[model samples]
Target: MLREQGSAIRNTLDSVLSLSNQKAYPVWESVNSFALIKAAEAGLGITILPENLLLDSLLHKKLRLIELDGIDMENKMLAILHKDKNITQPLKIILDNISNVL
Candidate 1:
């Protein structure tokens, strides 16, 4: 496994893999997305990353998507704020923009 350190997908990836019968593989973990992509391009191993991050490489055929059988690796972004906290005008506008875009 090629793992991205401190990535949100790490937890979900672990949970999904644990439920399967696949054997554990050695991991090359890094926090740098560029390094991860370089490693993958060099045929070191496969990794899971946001599609937007690798769009250019994918289009150039430098990397290819490896479909995982019976796995849903899709993820959604969530913006959380404390209910007790006050929402300032700027914050509200930012949140509204994000909500509208999404």
Candidate 2:
């Protein structure tokens, strides 16, 4: 998931380096957003993630952003529901919540 629509995350990092004229550095990868957030909040290291993932944390002053000037991107994800299966009220509510968040 670190790679956005098409390696956008990695591409974004490269672009940041190019723009800043900074030295190349290694980046740690995480399997999920929760892990990334936890590691970053624990002072492990900084990270670049979809802004939405860090919105609440930033609002509460739990995390900060390192601006990459001139960069603009949106990350998208898909959830598929089987058409053959009946969607119950609970499932509908869950799907609605997910939709609303995105």
Candidate 3:
């Protein structure tokens, strides 16, 4: 979840509440890379983490991480420009080249 603190907490709570009705489980919180590794080492909970976070040494043998498609946000690196500036020929060519890859 690409959410700020409060929203992340709410989402985690909702997941915990839903799981509670079916089985006994532990609920965790939204945490940065270091905190999450510590939580896992303490045997407190599991989390949905991105692949990039696992490169840290704390994550090694500490977290039981999994990958899920369609669970993460899709971010596009866009170039925002003012409409008033008339795009020069060189700029137009560059934009066209970027669009091709996208």
| Candidate whose TM-score is highest | 1
Clashes of each: 0, 0, 0
Model 1 per-residue lDDT tens digits across residues 1-102: 445534676766766777885543547777777788888889888878777778888999999987777788766788999989899999999999988765
What is the C-alpha lDDT profile of model 2 across 53-76, one tens digit per residue? 899789988888887666665555
Stretches off by above 4 angstroms in model 3 are 1-26, 57-59, 69-102
RMSD of 3: 7.9
- Candidate 1: where is the Cα deviation over 4 Å? 4-6, 84-89, 96-102
Evaluated against the true structure, the overall lDDT of model 3 is 0.55
lDDT (Cα, 0-100) at 99 in candidate 2:
89
lDDT by residue for model 3 (1-102), tens: 222344443355445545546422335444454576566567765644444555553356655556554344333458889989899999999999988755
TM agreement with the true structure for every prediction: 0.69, 0.56, 0.37
lDDT of each: 0.76, 0.70, 0.55
Question: What is the Cα-based lDDT of residue 89 in candidate 3?
Answer: 100
After TM-score superposition, what is the CA distance of residue 73 in candidate 1 from its true location, in Å? 1.4
Q: After superposition, how far is residue 44 of candidate 2 from its true place, in Å?
A: 2.1
In candidate 1, how many clashes are counted?
0
